[model samples]
Target: MPLNNIPADRSYTDEHEWIMISPGQTSVPTSPVRVGITSVAAAALGELVFLDLPEVGSEIEAGRTCGEVESTKTVSDLYPPVSGEVTSLNQAAIDDPSLVTQDPYGSGWLFEVQPTQLGTLLTAQEYAEKNGA
Candidate 1:
């Protein structure tokens, strides 16, 4: 289920990832933006133990497995909500995977990308409903 606190400020993917738009940017973005797993995903994963992040300069597609997140309960693939070239990987999250469970939306961001596929993303409301929040 989606959390009400999942900010209405940006779009979310059905795969449970959230896309945070960079400041000063609006719709149909082509510049780098923050990306992270949602709280609902963090909770389901259960006690994150490791996170494999895509390298900068890597090309990723929306809905395609880009990396992985390992939790005490399971290991799960991480998907980008929109397709783009990865511009940066969060060294902080890689260094301390537990940060993902502690703060999935903020300091736990997975990557930055200059998105090329924003058209497929869902609004916050749509994500919430689709997830049965």
Candidate 2:
């Protein structure tokens, strides 16, 4: 799964988060972005133990802890790639954390956002290159 990563095309954060911008989607292009953790993050966490998602309509700041994950007996905070309002959380992921280990980019996605800023993230290729993947 790591070899064929379906990386977010938009940008990422140094904290290992990914953001996908959806333009012409009936909302402000930069406001409501989709956010998730990088595959690197999932791999580091090993088998997921638990997940906590933000309530819908909550405002989140970039680099701030919005949620958390418990894996391998350790808890890690989930960071936002960009500032935004959470529009939706991945209910499926909340139900099953193991999916994060199986498909970090697909079924493991954490939440969707209405980004307040999209310029503050790194590109998918850039993030992979930075992490030496």
Candidate 3:
């Protein structure tokens, strides 16, 4: 993938998760951040088979395992980019876990979190640079 194609607006983790501040009813300074597996991660995981998601309103801590994602090759923990309450989870992805590999940065989002602390994450450029993009 082209390094330039990495969405400039979001932050990424080495674990292959992408997180962006969701544009809430307000300006989203303190609103939830949408969480999802990155295309790189999705591609590496192969076809997704199942997604174990957390319930809405679940208090999750930053950098902790909030759920699990089972793929054709392996089962990986879904980590939160930031610590906060889970506002919502994508039922569509739950029903069709393959959506995670289909559109990793879009409708395949895992959950929305109202962050209490932004964990150690990297910007798109930073991630690209770190990964030799």
For model 2, the stretches where C-alpha displacement exceeds 4 angstroms are: 1-8, 22-31
Candidate 3 residue-wise lDDT at 98: 92
In order of TM-score, best first, we have 1, 3, 2
Candidate 1 regions with alpha-carbon error over 4 angstroms: 1-3, 22-27
- In candidate 1, position 98 carries an lDDT of 86
| TM-score head-to-head 1 vs 2, winner | 1
Candidates, ranked, lDDT: 1, 3, 2
RMSD of each: 3.1, 3.7, 3.6
Model 1, backbone clash pairs (residues 3+ apart or across chains), number: 0
lDDT of 3 by residue, 87-132 (tens): 9899999999999889988899999988877777887777778766
For candidate 2, the lDDT comes to 0.73
Put down candidate 2 lDDT per residue, 74-121, tens digits, no spaces.
898988866668898888888988987787767777889886654456
Q: List the residue pairs that clash in candidate 2.
A: 12-122, 31-114, 31-115, 32-114, 33-113
After aligning candidate 1 to the native by TM-score, how far in Å is the CA of 58 from where it should be?
0.6
Please state the error at residue 95 of candidate 1 in Å: 0.8
